[model samples]
Target: MDAAVAAIEESGPSGWSLRELARRAGVSHAAPAHHFGDKTGLLTALAAEGFGLLADALTAAGDGLLDLGVAYVRFAVRHRAYFEVMFRPELYRPDDPELTAARTRADELLGDAVRPLSPEPEAALAAWSIAHGFAGLWLSGALPPEVGTDPEAAARPVLGTLFPYDEDGRPAAEPPRER
Candidate 1:
């Protein structure tokens, strides 16, 4: 797994080959195929691992949507290789069982984290979209350099407005809208 991570990080989804991976790990060229079946299999495993890490990090952050956003950016920075493949379904097999399970687990984690703050089911989806959008912006270098200096800190003020919170730091209830 470490070898796969290293190769993906250094090159990208398409850059690494099984032979080079075997060379780095001091194993025969067939070793990776035996373990992962192929490049897609390897990437699927990597995405699963990445999703697990994301779940743990988001759970630990405890800042609700804000913390989840921070964790998303942190995950990208911390696991650039995994992050690169986790979202690129074309790079690997989308139907892989492990990848499917991992994607489900990650989505569930996001749902659990955002559900409480949402007044309606759609609200949870909206919250997740916003958080993910912010994280994507950060990962894509769209945020200003100062924002990147301390991503969490810089993002807080903007995200705070997007997801209103009370003085206690919990998300505030949404107000009534026009009928």
Candidate 2:
């Protein structure tokens, strides 16, 4: 897993090959195929692992949406390879059972996190969008330098723009309207 992560991070989704991965891992060329079946299977496994790790991180975020958003960005920055593959279904087999279960776990974590904010199903979607958007930007260094490169420190203020907290640190206004 670590070897795959390193290769993906260094070479991107399309840049790395299974044979190269085996070479990097100091294993036989057929080792990765034997373990994961093929490149797609390897990527699928990576995505599943990434989602599972994301779920764990988000679950560990014990605060409100801001905290969860921060965790999301942090996870993306921390697990660049997994985070990258998790969203690129074409890079892996979307119908894989383990992949589906892992993705579901991550989705359920976000859904549960947003449940208390609103009964509207869209709330979960909005929460995910904002967090993911910010995280992606942060990962790409698209965020301005003023926001700082630190994921957690930068996330509080930026995410707060979408879900501002009052002086008492409670969610401001009317539960943050999406439309």
Candidate 3:
């Protein structure tokens, strides 16, 4: 798994093979195939692992929506290899039971956090999109230098714009918008 993560980081999800992963892991060329069955199987496992890790991170962040958003970005940047493969459903089996359960867990965490903010279903989607979009921008180097190298710090204000909170984790009043 470590070798596979390294390969995904250095190349990309589709750029490496099971043979390459075996070679990097110092195992026989057929070892990865024997264990994971094929590249899709390996990626399915990776996607499941990524979602589980994400759920853990979000849970650690507590129930604060702002904190959850920051945690999402932090997980993506820290686990770039897993994050890359987890989102691209075309690369793996999205319907795999393990992957589905893991993904659903992460989604539920996010939805639970957003529920108090608005009763509307779109609120959860909007919150997820904001965090996911910001993470994608940070990973792609699309964010300006002024955003700084600290992902959590950078993410806080951006997420705050959508779901403002005070030091005590209570929702804060939105700032007045300019004409």
Candidate 4:
């Protein structure tokens, strides 16, 4: 898995093969195939693991939407390989039980975090879109240098813009709107 992650990071999700992973891991060329069945299986496993890890990180970030958004970005930047594969369902079996469960757990956690901020479902979707969009931009190196290299630090302010909170951790007042 380490070799696969490294290969995915260095190249991409489809750039490397099981044989290459085995070679990098110092195992027989057939080892990865024997363990994971095929590239899709391996990617499926990686996606499941990635979602599980993401769920853990978000849980640890507490129930705050801003903190959860930061955790999402942090997980993406740190686990680039997993993040790359997890969202691209074409690369893996999205209906796989393990993968579905993990993905569902992460989704539930995100929804729960956003619940207090707004009762509307759109709020959760918007928050997720903002975080995921920012993470994708950061990972693709499309974000400007002024954004800096610190994923957490950069993410906090941007996420705060969406779900602003006061010092006591309650949602802040919305700014006046133009007529």
Candidate 5:
């Protein structure tokens, strides 16, 4: 899996092939195909792994939805290949069970993160849409170039708009304050 991720990172998703993944893994050329069935299968598994990581990160951030947003953006920037594969259904088989499960889990995690606000689905969607849009924009360089220079600093204001915050810079309406 690490080999697959490294290959995708080094050469983009288009360059990732089962043979190349097997070669990187020091396995037979057919090894990846045997295990994954094909490139799409491998990508589905990869997306699942990425979403699992995302779910964990979101859970860890607890009521700090702003931090969760930051973590998400950071994850995307750091795992460009996996993030793209996870979100861009056209690039892979969306019907794959692994991909479907991953997507569901990811959404559940996001829902949990936004639940504290008692937001209606529309509000939750809006908050998620903004965060997702910002992350996508940051990854695509659609945001100011300087934003990348210090992503956390640049994103704080935008996150503040999307995240409920008290006057003291802490997440509002959360107690025990830890999720």
Candidate 6:
């Protein structure tokens, strides 16, 4: 898996062949095919692994939505190959059972993070979109220097927009105090 990820990162969107992955893994040329069936099957497992890792990070962030968003961006930059493969469904088995389970695990975590505010699907989708979009932009180097290189630092203010604070920097849902 590590070798495949390295190959993907080094090869770009066209990705690497199973034989190449086998060679990198120091295995027989048919080893990857025997285990994964084909390139898409291997990519499906890769995508599942990526989503599972993302779920672990977000789960560790706990109930803090801001921290969760920050972790999302950080994970993207740290695991560029996995992130790239995970989103390109056409490159893998989009309906693979393991992939679906992994995606659901991540989705459940995101749902828990946003449940305190509202259980609306729109809220979850909006949060996912912003975090995903921000990470994608950062990975692509499309974000200007003003955004800075620190994923968490750059994402803080952007995520704060979706999860704002009051005068005291507390969530606005809290009761107001005297001036």
Model 3 bad stretches (over 4 Å): 173-179
RMSD (CA, Å), each prediction: 2.5, 2.0, 2.5, 2.3, 4.6, 3.8
> Tens-digit lDDT track for model 2 on 1-179?
67889988898887888899999899999999999998899999999888889988988986577778888889998899898899999999999888899889888877876776677788888889888998888888888888865788877777777666775435666676666
Cα lDDT tens digits, model 6, 1-179, are 88888987898746678888888889999999999998888889999999999999898876777778888998999999999999999989888899999999999898888777766787789889999999999988899999886888899799878866554434568422323
| Per-residue alpha-carbon lDDT of candidate 5 for residues 1-179, written as tens digits (9 for 90 to 100) | 88888987788776767887888899999988888888877877888888877777677765566777777777777777788777766667778777678778878777766777755676568667877788788877888766657666677678778666876545677532223
Give stretches of model 6 more than 4 Å off: 166-171, 174-179
> Per-model C-alpha lDDT, please?
0.76, 0.83, 0.91, 0.89, 0.74, 0.85
Q: What is the alpha-carbon lDDT for the whole of candidate 6?
A: 0.85
Q: What is the lDDT of residue 63 in candidate 4?
A: 74
How does residue 170 of candidate 1 score in lDDT?
64
Off by over 4 Å in 1: 119-121, 173-179
Q: 58-125, model 1: which lDDT tens digit per residue?
A: 77877567667667767777778888888888878888777788777777777776776654768667
Better of 3 and 6 by lDDT: 3
lDDT winner among the candidates?
Answer: 3
Cα miss at 27, model 2 (Å)? 1.0
Tell me the number of clashing residue pairs for each predicted model: 0, 0, 0, 0, 0, 0
**Residue pairs with backbone atoms closer than 3 Å in model 2 (clashes):** none
Give, for candidate 3, the lowest lDDT window spanning 10 residues. 170-179
Model 2 global lDDT (CA atoms, 0 to 1): 0.83
| Candidate 4 lDDT tens digits, 4-68 | 89999999999988989999999999889999999999999999999999999999988778788
Q: Measured by C-alpha RMSD in angstroms, how accurate is candidate 5?
A: 4.6
| TM-scores, one per candidate | 0.85, 0.91, 0.94, 0.92, 0.83, 0.91
Count: clashes, candidate 2: 0
